[model samples]
Target chain A: MDVRSRNHVTVTGRVGGPVVMLAHGFGCDQNMWRLVVPALERDFTVVLFDHVGSGNSELSAWSPERYSSMDGYAEDVLELCRELALGPVTFVGHSVSAMMGVLAAAREPEAFAGLVLLAPSACFIDDPDTGYRGGFSAADIDELLESLDANYLGWSGAMAPVIMGNPERPELGEELTNSFCRTDPGIARVFARVTFLSDNRRDLSQVRVPTLVAQCSSDAIAPPEVGEFIHAQIPGSRLTTLNATGHCPQLAAPEETAAAIAAFARAAG
Target chain B: MTCGTGGEEGGRERDNGSGPGEEEALFSALLEDSTEDLYEHAPCGFLSTLLDGRIAKANATLLDWLGYRRSDLVGRRHFSDLLTVGGRLYYETHFGPLLRMQGEVSGVALELKAADGSRLPVMVTSKVKTGIDGQPLLIRTTVFEARDRRAYETELLRARREADQERDRLKLLNATLQTTLLPPALANVPGLDVSAYYHIASADEVGGDFYDLFPLATGTWGLFLGDVCGKGATAAAVTSLARYTLRAAAVYDPDPAAVLANLNTVLNHEYNGDDPRFCTVVFGLLTPDADRGGFHIVLASGGHPPALMMRADGTADFLPTPGGQLIGVLPDAHIATATVHLAPGDTLLLYTDGLTEARTAAGGEDRYGDDALLAFIRDLAPSTASDTIGAVRVLLGTFGTGVDDDTAVLAVHVPRAGSEERH
Candidate 1:
């Protein structure tokens, strides 16, 4: 059934079949699952939608204060599920959304059957006392922010290579640069602060679902240690490492990522 | 000739009468020559140091800047004696070595301690004097007030730090904001495998490639992927507006072409002035056709690159939906639509131009174009949606730094019957 979401949440797939939900990471949207959906549609129902401020979603639904925290996003997820009667869903999230899914599943564990997280980051800022690796220091973050404000396009252009760092066939930097240049500076500014500065390590313990954490071995943004931390914190969570160096493994190693998901889904079933 | 002779005679007579005047002129010349000497005593103190790093001569200008008297430095104390501890160390370690090697060192920044214990910033230049035998005799040093330079340097450093902090805040804000522009994840539709990948060429900021596949009506899905022109705040604003408008408009009417038309109208109207915004997009409606046991996809394009059709037989080609115009350019846009039957084992790929146009190398000469993409898929025939996207994802990874543009790829595949539902 069609339902209205404050965030323009649209429902798809079989209404009565088991619901499978997907979420993208920082700098991406729900479309990351396009390659995985067709194969999934064979047995279960699927539900896909952008976050409130995400792709093809309601821009007005974005409030800096509201989106600053993932609680509102979790609420939107729960509300969308309720509206579509897509209960007992298998929540699959990428990057920051992994923590977001944790937040949602924690609030309504009964609403979800399992969670598959791809390249998840619980905390992106370092905590020396806790031994957490966030890649850059607070000073570095300050420098990065200044760079962004000074010239958003320039900063994005410079960062493309770092974001798409792959040892072999390293040409995705241009793609990242173009992407950075295509976005509005204001939106990019806000999104940069939210993705890098916001830390949500404490939220991992709250997850109680059958969680599968897929991590990239050489991700500069969210290193391997982070995946281990998430797996350690989230009780009964399984961790698998993909031999990729990029921040977005699904885009870099889709076959391995899909295989992992397929294997995990089967194991869960 | 008579007038010249008379003038010469008159000049000679004048000259004869001007001996006293000549003497007075000489006296005046002497007085005028002493002006530099007078400068030494004219309120400001001055001083010069010898080549051996000792005070050889000093004037009032030098004494004033250092808050010292001539008796305290000239022929009495070494020039380094008036320096602060740090300044003396710096002079000995760095300044002395450089000056000795260079023969002359100008504007050597240093700090001096005053008699009253206050610090004085000064720029000093010193040159070595040599005798006729080419033997070094002494050093002559000049000092300039450096309070302003010090202040300026301090201000510059402060500004740099502030700018860095501001950039960091923006980066985080940009990251989060960028996240909001796309879905956290696209759900796996039952009976079909799906995979999508968005390649952002940058991370210090945001990009304008947007895509989504969300539930619309009963047993149907709505999905779209598009690229907005330009970057920074303006492009981001348009991106947000377009993303939301498309989703909202789709909810209003789930028709792929109509949804794009609605988006086109909103963007054109909202950003219709000078410095207007526009974008290339492809919108699709996926409904499970029980007759096909897959999906009936109505794909629409708005000046966007065509979606690739990777058939179950392993043939991949651009789904020809040409003649579409860019959204937000005109009041009314022609959105091209195409209907396709997604059979089991069929995979459809939608992507932004960033993928096709991305440079295959640092020089950006070799592009991963339509033919190359088709050839690539030809090798991976009979691929599932996830598999196809996974392969493309690897391709994106392989492109590495060459793919300078942000690419958004949305792939939908119809899984074959009797395939393992799980795992």
Candidate 2:
């Protein structure tokens, strides 16, 4: 199988420079990075690819047994890196892909130079015994899943605005909603379960790369405490709280998000 | 009252409200009394919160449901504080942001924590009140009791989960029943190495493919492999009947061709109608030849794939039994017979069409046909029975989801003279 066709990889920007790979999260595809790409493209090589069940990637490549967990997604990331011969590239992951980067970087530290996690959560369900807050309970996750299964269109309409978080710019929310609606409903249901039910807390401590956690202010999806938890677990990691509000800072506040990432990438390099 | 005597004067008096002053006083008093009563004791709970989610004002009906005083909520607690932990999380993540972005959200299911620590299921609808400049000022919310809806949804979820469990149980039952149709274990043939494997394409549905290797009489063994016309209970019935009949008939005659003839007669007699059933089977009778120090095997094929033989000296070929008709298809199905000797270190393999007809490539347009199997066996000449079966198992795994049919393989090898103990 062609790895490029498998991931629908798109590479642009300065040649022979440092490569910055952008991986989108669960609901949207690589197009979610549209606003943030131009900022880094001036100096760095920007690479973007959708996960297999999202965007223009081949739908036939989806196998339930292969993609039952995040490990399979991590394999795709590593495969993409190896195909491009990108050595020690910088990885920028949004939402669930943030954890994918963590898993990849932990397993193969030599493949990544630095990590930028945007609105990432190592776990989504709250663990009462540990007093750790993941912003959702198991029942809430169940309700969310049921809502997705019952009326996917209504769920998309109700959830896209909440995830995008900018009332002033309704177009952003509209775009996010459209992206959610465009996805295959069955794949989206499975992907949603995989995303929210996953627990990568133990993988956080294994991240050896220079990591930057960029959390937005008042983000309901990933609370401030979750960001602090990630920063604490990852040794020598920097935590920067952006002035932006909501779960998606890349779409909500691109300039600040890009500036923060660029500053970290330059320093890490 | 006195003006009623005149027609135009009485009409003017009534129109100007001079005739019924007492009745007008009662209607105005009723309207003034009900306005406040409506807000306080409405059917739904009503609340207004500050921009930061703190409670600004709550209606009397909401306070009564939660068993809280107006002072306890207003100016003291946030609206999120009244929700259960999970509901609070959902409110913060999905509800609050949606209200901010869309200005309103409706029919969101949530649970509110009451004063006594019990949970109240409610459906909430909230709207962000905006200022003159289009900036959000506060949030106005309506809460409806959803006890009936919650109970119904819970029942629905429970029923769905039970149905899933029941389906899994049925699959297990079918699998167990399918296993019973085959031999528990191939009879231990002294001085010979034997192996068999069954590849099931689906766990939910039972396939009609079956195989067995069992002893018949002194110094002779009966081995047969077949695939019934269809799957599920109907084909399974035919498969069981054919397997038992073949075993029982071999005991009476011991000739491979005669045993298959008996099965054809029984099937043709039992089913000769619109819903007729049939199968392709190959039966083999093996006997030790003391003079040659090898085994003499006679195979009878009834529209089955030819058996492959791998010689000890790195040579492989198929023992063809052509011109045979499918068993049970006719009154007297033609059974073709072929005889071969399994010398020292030689192996013979019998398999159903599942192997040759499997989709070999990723596109699934091509099959792993007879020629491909011949070539594959040629590469593995001089192989033992277990080794041949293991190699085929690995190849089948590579085919992944393309192999949409059940496969049964049986191989028997006569070990070299000195290696009988190892075999």
TM-score (chain A only) for the predictions, listed in order? 0.79, 0.89
Q: After superposition, how far is residue B105 of candidate 1 from its true place, in Å?
A: 6.0
Q: For this target, which candidate reaches the highest lDDT against the unseen true structure?
A: 2
Give one digit per residue, the lDDT tens place, for model 2 in B1-423.
544333686667667766477546545765676867888888999999986677999999999999999999999988878876545544653465446545677777777888998778887888888888976788899999988987776677678768879999989988997899889999998878999999988887788898888898888998999999888889889999999998899989989999999999999988988888899999999899788867999999999999999999989999999998899999888999999999988999999998988998756689999999999999999899999999999989988877888999999998888874345
Tell me the alpha-carbon RMSD of every candidate.
23.8, 9.5
**Candidate of highest TM-score:** 2
Per-residue lDDT for A1-269 in model 1, tens only?
13354444545655576667777665445555655666666655767777656545556666777676667667777887787675688877877777778888999998888898888887777889977886556554554444333333233333333322254644544443343234344554465566667787887888878999888875545678888888998999999898754455554456677677766765664
Worst window of 10 by summed lDDT in candidate 2 chain A: A147-156
lDDT of 1 by residue, B245-301 (tens): 988998899998899989888987897778779999999898898986888999999
Tell me the RMSD of model 2 versus the true structure.
9.5
